[model samples]
Target: MSAPTPQPTALTLHQASRVLEVGFDDGAVFRIPFELMRVYSPSAEVQGHGPGQETLQTGKRDVGISQIELVGHYAVQPSFTDGHDTGLFTWGLLYKLGSEQAELWSRYEQRLAEAGVTRDTPMPAKTGGACASH
Candidate 1:
């Protein structure tokens, strides 16, 4: 007989820490970083609709989860601070991501380097009004 599929028993988003804690029925608990989740989003915007069309996500090193909503009984949709809310993070995918975080993160970094992108660079501050006189 095959083992039963694991399901999430609890999900918590730590905004300050920028981490998502997921506890599974199989006694596995994973703390996934917000940046990792953002870059690895399962949305077509990142993964595309077919093979070899995956887009490399960058500039999300400081991203955070703004919201998490249940999608039926199979998945949760996380709305990112970067305005990404289309990925459906299924239990299976979440488990895989958690289990392979180190390797996946390494690959992501490599891809960013190849693309001449660096997460260390911060976004420029927005300025309003040019030298307004008081």
Candidate 2:
């Protein structure tokens, strides 16, 4: 098997609009939105560890990123205002999202529609979780 690729050392996060501007060492850049990140979280709490265990995320339409904490040297943990930070987005995962953002976003929207969930609002302030460990 081939060796794993390296993570980007030049990661920029713009917290104003809750977006992550990730730049790779190879001159690649991707801007990820908070909504997208929350909806596609890889955590078991959000994505679940097994099949048929996915928990659909909703009411994050207006959620903004509170912080982007780097976990070690490989992944980033984004903390959302809605109190979600379980998903640790690794370099490879970020690259995948950057490459297929459009397709992934479309798929997510479709799936949400099929599930009858609408991310149209933010959760109450009391509802919070470990979205970032920094």
lDDT of each: 0.85, 0.78
TM-score per candidate: 0.85, 0.81
Model 2 per-residue lDDT tens digits across residues 53-73: 777777876778878888987
Residue-wise C-alpha lDDT for candidate 1, range 37-78, written one tens digit per residue: 888899877786778778777678889888999999899999
Model 2 TM-score is 0.81
Clashes of each: 0, 2
lDDT of 1: 0.85
